[model samples]
Target chain A: MQYLNNIGTYFLMIIELFRKPTKWSVMRHLILKDIDDLIIGSLGIVSFIAFFVGGVVTIQTALNIDNPLIPKTLVGFATRQSILLEFAPTFMSIIMAGKVGSFITSSIGTMRVTEQIDALEVMGINSLNYLVFPKLVAMAFYPFVISIAMFLGIIGGLTACVYGGYSSVDDFITGIQQDFQPFHIVYAFIKTFLFAFVLATIPSYHGYYMKGGALEVGEASTTSFVWTSVTIILLNYLATQLLLS
Target chain B: MIEVKNLHKSFGDAHILKGISNTFEQGKTNLIIGQSGSGKSVFLKCLLGLYDYEEGSIEYNGEVFANLSEDKKRDMRAKIGMVFQGSALFDSLTIEENVMFPLRMFTKLKKDEMRERASIVLKRVNLEDAHKKMPSEASGGMQKRVAIARAIVNNPKYLFCDEPNSGLDPKTAIVIDNLIHEITEEYNITTVINTHDMNSVMEIGDSIMFLKDGLKAWEGSKKTIFKTDNKIVTDFVYSSNLFKKVREAVLKEQG
Candidate 1:
């Protein structure tokens, strides 16, 4: 019953976002701040993980190919497919469910506890719009982060392939270019866009509607991350089925 | 003037505020005092329209609040300034920006104009030097002052404060209470405060209402209370010996 109430409330919050207009001056500043916090802040962690994870994927693919008949180029092919299809978009969003998701929940939860949200409401400000809309605008830049992840992840893979002596540069490059479909990149970006919405609103719902004080804020953050990650994971599979499968 | 008629509110089976009726006069500091769990906060929230009363009409300056259109509610809310118990200044904003916030949102004033007004209001609260500081960087008293500056910066028609002196030392609390009253008179704004401080009840309560378990138990001016024979009011007012001394001194001074 509580879950159903949350789902209904989440949709209602989205409707509220469009009904009340916020001052553009304030909205612009809020958007810029959120971009800096959500996107730029996550760049370092995303890049670090992307690079190492890409290297590991390449090494694992090469090691698994025990047959002499399978082309060495297949290692690069498999690496590109894995990183572009699932690793960059889906996996990174899950990581962000922990990183960015926790941030959205705790910051907003703190505001709720501190009566800052109440202050906004009393001032005739739509607290939901003031709080959540900037985050939605900022998450529009999520794909930019994923684009960087794709670049760095592939670079890390090539570097690992060279160092591991699993495949030659030309062979790996051939495998990456082999039957490369533009539709796959399009599919990855679509998931990123959808995941971006989930990123902005799910955690916000938890924090905004949460009850209790400081300790509850922490608990809400944890619960928000869990639900956000689970939602992203489910939507990922759903999107893959609808868009890819 | 704000007139709440037969206002009743409940949270599920709890039934918090029951048939509360009162008129908060303009240019005066009206106080609602009660023990904890007496529904003071809930009543304040209902008056602010942050909570809806299930059975009552709140008339703000003669227009029923429930009858106002959504746009009108927004306009009315813009006129209502609130100083939360915790001050509730935006932690991310500087004191200057915090005070200038409502202006920037509701008015098309140039940035310099907003800053100028913020400066004047902050100076009114005796916080001229602390504009660049954050809320966390200020003392409890300074934060309450900033909250007041923010509340009044837009020249609101009504002001509400929930426990504005809850955390301050006695001296600082008195300063804050007096400042709020002065602002109320200076602006001719209808101001309502929720507090349990007998000092506040004795100090600036031009009109005081006491709530007991969500019911209006007593309603009178500060002067009337001193001469009245009501047990609840007398017991609650003289609950502390210090207040008793203060009341005796006031009576002695008056005689």
Candidate 2:
């Protein structure tokens, strides 16, 4: 019952977030700031995680297929599939649910604690729209970050495959290109977009509704991280089942 | 003027405000004074339309708030400026940008115009040189002054302050009180303040409403606050021995 209540509240909040829009002059600055905070700020960590994980996935795939009868190119195939199909979109979002999600939650939760939200409301501004809408708009660029992750992941896999003697550069390149479905990129991005929405809203829900002081802001951020990751994973499973299976 | 009629508010099973009604006049500092848990904050929030009251009508310059449409309510709210107990300045922006925020949101003024207007208010609040600083870098007194600057930057017709001097030293608190008083007269605004600071009550409370457990225990000006024999008002106002002796001396002098 409590879960249902929260879900209903979250939906209501999303609806409120779009209504009574803030003036574009103010909203423009807020959107730019959020882009800097939520998207641009996340690039470095996402790139680092994607590169190393892609390398590890390639090395592990190579070790698993020790038989000479198996084509060495299969290592590249598996790495490409892992990084694009799951690693770049789903795994990276889980990581962001910690980095970006905690940031959104803590920043907003602190505002709530200090009555900044009330200040906005009293000023006749729609606080939900003012605070959360920019984030939602910024997360529209989430796929841009994931695209970078996908590119770096493949590059890292290629470097590892060539350097680790897992496969020749030619074979790895062929494997990446071989039988690749354009639809998979679309499917991955579809999931990325959904996760992006989750990333922005779930944490905002925790932050905007949070009640308490400084200690509670920290607690809200942790809860927001947990819930955002959980929601992203759940949505990934649902999307995969519907889109892939 | 702001008038409240039979305001009532409750939270779940707890009734926070039984019924509160009072008129806060314009061009003067109107104060709501009560001990902790006496629903002073709640009453102020209800007046600001931040909370939904169970029963009551609040009239702002004779327009019943509950009767207005959402758009009208928002239009009304736009005329209000509030200074929170915590100052509630945006942490991300510089103090100058913080003061300019309401103008940015509500006006179509050019950036230079907004900056100019912000400077005017900041100067009014005696925050002439702190524009580049963040709220976190400001002292409590400075932050309160910035809050005042932000509140009046948009030229609101009504100003509400929730303990605008909460954590400041006595000297700074008096400065804030005097600033609010001056702004009230300058703007001819319907100013309502929620505070328990007796010094504020005595200094600038042109009209005072004393709430006890959500009910109006007494209503008077700062002059009458000392003269009132109402025990609730006297007990809360003179809880300190120094104030008690001062009240006694005043009574003797008056007698």
Candidate 3:
């Protein structure tokens, strides 16, 4: 019942968030700052993680093929498929659910604790729009981040496959291009966009409505990350079943 | 001027503010003073339209607040400034940007113009040299002064403060109270402050409203509060030993 109530309030907040548009001059600065915080700032970790994890996934896939009859090209195919289908779009988002989600929650939660939200309200600003909308706008660029992850993951996998002697570079390239479908990219990006929305909003919901003091801000951040990851996983399943199946 | 008539607020079977009525005059420091849990904060929130009451009406300049449309309400709110208990400065921004926030939100002034306007208010609050500093680097008194600068930068007609001096030393608290008082008179704003600080009460309680268990128990000014015989008001006001002696000294002097 409480979950239902929270869901209802979340939708209402989304509605209210778009209603009173803040002056674009202020919103422009806010949006750029959010892009810097949520997107550009995330590039370093995303690149490092994507590269190393892709190598690990390739090495693992190469080892799993003990059947001597299996083609060497299959290693590259599996790496490409995994990186594009789930690793880049879904798994990377779970990582962001920790990084970006906690940031939104704690920053906004601290503002609530310090009565900055009330100050905005008393100033007649729609605190929701002022605080959350820019984040939403910035997260629209989440696909850009995922694209980098996808590119780096494939590069990492190619390096592992060729250096590990699991497959020749030409065979891996052929495997990557053998059955490529453009729609797979579209589907992955669709999931990325939906997860981006979830990442921006679920954390904001926790932070904006959080009560108590500093202790609760930490708690809200944990809860928000859990909820964001849960929502992204659920949405991934639903989107796959609906779009791919 | 702001007027509240029989304002009532409740929270899920807990009646917080019950039929409280008062008029806060313009150009003066109007205070709502009460013990903890007496609904003083709730009353101020209701006046600021942060909380909606179930009954009665709140009027600003003779226009009923609850009757205004959403757009009109927002426009009215833009004319009102608030200083929060924690000084609520945007931690990420420099002091100058914090003061310039309202202008950016509500006006089309160029960046230089906004900076100039922000400087004027920062200077007014004696923070001219602190523009590049962040809120985290500021002392408690400096933060309070920055809050005052932010509150008045937009030239609001009404100003509301929630415990404007909660965590400061006695001297700094008095300084904040005096700043609010001076700004109230200077801007002719309808200022409403919710506080229990005895120093603030004695220093700038131009028109004071005493709330007891969510009801208005007494009403008077700084001088009149010193002489009030209402037991509820007297008990709460003179509970501290120092204020008790001060009250007795004032009474003896009068006699």
- Predicted candidate 2 versus true structure: per-residue lDDT over A1-245, tens digit per residue: 99999999999999999999998877898999999999999999999988989899999998899789988778888898999999999999999999999999999999999999999998878899999999999999999999999999999999988999888999998888877999999999999999999999999999999998999999999999999998898999999999999
Which pairs of residues clash in candidate 3, taking residues 3 or more apart in a chain or in different chains?
none
- Could you tell me the TM-score of candidate 2? 0.98
Candidate chain B TM-scores, in order = 0.97, 0.98, 0.98
Backbone clashes for every candidate come to: 0, 0, 0
Best-first order by lDDT: 1, 3, 2
Question: In candidate 3, what are the lDDT values of residues A1-245, reduced to their tens digit?
Answer: 99999999999999999988888878999999999999999999999999989888889999999998988888888988999999999999999999999999999999999999998898889999999999999999999999999999989999998999988999888878878999999999999999999999999999999999999999999999999999999999999999999
Candidate 1 chain A TM is 0.99
What are the runs in model 2 whose C-alpha is more than 4 Å off?
none
Better of 2 and 3 by lDDT: 3
Q: Candidate 2 chain B, which ten residues in sequence have the lowest lDDT sum?
A: B17-26
Query: Candidate 1: where is the Cα deviation over 4 Å?
Result: B248-255
Interface RMSD of 3: 0.8
Which ranking of candidates, highest DockQ first? 1, 2, 3
Given candidate 1, what's the lDDT at residue A199?
95
Of 2 and 3, the candidate ranking higher by DockQ: 2
- Model 3 / residue B18 / CA error / Å: 0.9
